[model samples]
Every structure is written in structure tokens, then in C-alpha cells.
Target: TLENIHELALGIELAGVRFLWALRKPAGTGNDEELLPAGFEERTRLRGLVCTGWVPQVTALAHGATGAFLTHCGWGSTIESFAFGLPLVMLPFIIDTPMIARAMAKRGIGVEVARDESDGSFDRDGVAVAVRRVMVEDEGKVFATNAKKLKDLVVDEGRQEQYIHELEDHLRRNKDV
Candidate 1:
């Protein structure tokens, strides 16, 4: 996984795109400092950020400057992206991720990055192409539009209050029983 991160960094560089990468180190040791390829930072100095710890996902997603969310397709991330109306660069790994990727694609709200195989292995070029397609090209705009509409559905005040009332009713009914 670490190796792929390096390759993706290289790919991101090659694609000539600006980026912000929030990285976490492998868990085998206590060190939290990310061990990205040497000079990766300095080399991409003009175009990228490689933050080495926890990042504020909601804040980042909400920011006007953020275009797409390159993410692991974890449930929390998927929902958050939808709520924020940010188009997704779905990189699903682990349980239910593949399904989520497929669903998002089918829904017209995101694009699933290509993998080397169905099992989800990938290289730098694939990462580059995916990023470019989402962040730099024409087709990606459709995803962005759809994502905004999806976001509007969630943020609609009437819809939100309805859900809250439904939850309160359920709680009250349960309390009486």
C-alpha cells in the first residue's frame, strides 16, 4: 500500500495537477511521520501538499476550492461526500467498498478509478488518469453537477427536519413501551 502511495504521488506529479495528500504511516511501528519517497515533497513543491497526519475531511470537503474527493469509499466518506456534494474519486478497499463504488458510478455521482483487475490492484498511471478525468477534463463536470443535486437533497431544510421528527417519534414510542 505504501508503495502504491508513492506511485500515485509520481502519477499525480506526471499528470501536472495540483494536489493535497493527507497521509498516515503504516501501523507496524510507533512512528507517525509518513515515509513518502525521498524528495517527493520538494520535487512537487510548486504543486502539491503531502500532509502526514489526520486531516479534517468535512472541512476540506466543504471548502469551495475542493473539486473532488479521492477517497477509500468507506461508508462514512461516501455519505459525507454526498452530503457535501463533492464528486468522488472512489478508491474502495475492504468490505462493501466495491459495492459502494459500483453504486456511486451507477448513480452518476462519481467515477470509479480503474484497477489492474477486479480485485482492485492499481498503478500510478491509473491514478493519474482517474484524477485527470475527474479534476481536469470535460466529462467530469457531469459528475460534479449530479453531486451538487444530490447534496441539495440532503441539505434541504424540510427533508432534514422531517427525519429529525421521525426519529423523535420513534424514540417517544419506544420510551412508552
Candidate 2:
């Protein structure tokens, strides 16, 4: 987990964009400084912030200045980002997240950071490329447009109620199966 954090720090630093990283300190680590790569704090002082405590994720996502979400593609976070019409840079690690990431990519809503085939490890370059693609590059515009479309769908109460009703009907029909 520490290794992942270190790599994330390196990657974000290399990305060289203004960032607010909500880093939960690893268990058994006493100080916040030890959780990051050496000189990372100093180097990124002007353009980056690593918060070690509770971060109000919804508030962050709602901020007008926020451009893209770098996330692990958990269902809740994914939904929240979509609700805000923020394009994503996904780095999924486990469970259904990778599948969700792939689906999102196919839908033009995000870019998944590339990982090593053997070890599934990602590096700074991959992180930078993914972030840039979703944040600054021309391709980002498409992702942004798609994200806005998704936001409309996500925030539509009528569509949500319809989905719920459909789910309930399907469950009722399949109750014995």
C-alpha cells in the first residue's frame, strides 16, 4: 500500500498540474512526511496539496475549478463524478473497479492509466499521460462532453425512478428463480 502511495505521489508530481491529493496515512506511519517521496512536499508546494485527514469528497467534486477526477472507479465515486460532469482518470485496483473502468473508457467518459501486464504496476509516465488526456488534451473535450451527458442522465429523477421500477419488476419476476 505504501508502495502504491509512493508511486501515486511520483506520478502526480510528474503530471505537473495543480492537485489536491487526499492521502490517508498508512497504518503504523507516524508522520505525514514519511508517507510521501523525499522532497515531494517541497517540490509540489505551489501546485499540489496532500491532505492526510478527512476530505469532503462531494464538496471537492462540486467545486467549479475542479476539472477531472483521478479515481479507483468505485461505484459511489464514479456516480459522484458523473453527477458533477467531471471526466475521470481511472486507476482501478480490485473487485469490479477494473471492469467499471473499462466500461467507462468504452463510453468515452474516462481514461484508465496503463499498467504492467505481469505485475499490474503503473508508473509516473502512465499517470501523467492519463491525467493529461483527461485534463488538457483535445481528447479531453470529448470526455467532458460525454461526462456532461452522463451527468444529465444521472441527475434525472424520472430516469432514476424508472430504473428503480424496472429493477423491482425484474426482481419480482425472478423471485422464484
Per-candidate TM-scores read 0.85, 0.93
Clashes of each: 0, 0
Candidate 1 segments exceeding 4 Å error: 29-34, 164-177
- Candidate 2 error regions (>4 Å): 28-33
TM-score of 1: 0.85
Clashing pairs in 1: none
User: What lDDT does the true structure give each of the candidates?
Assistant: 0.83, 0.93
Which clashing pairs does model 2 show?
A: none
* Residue 132 error, candidate 2, Å: 0.9
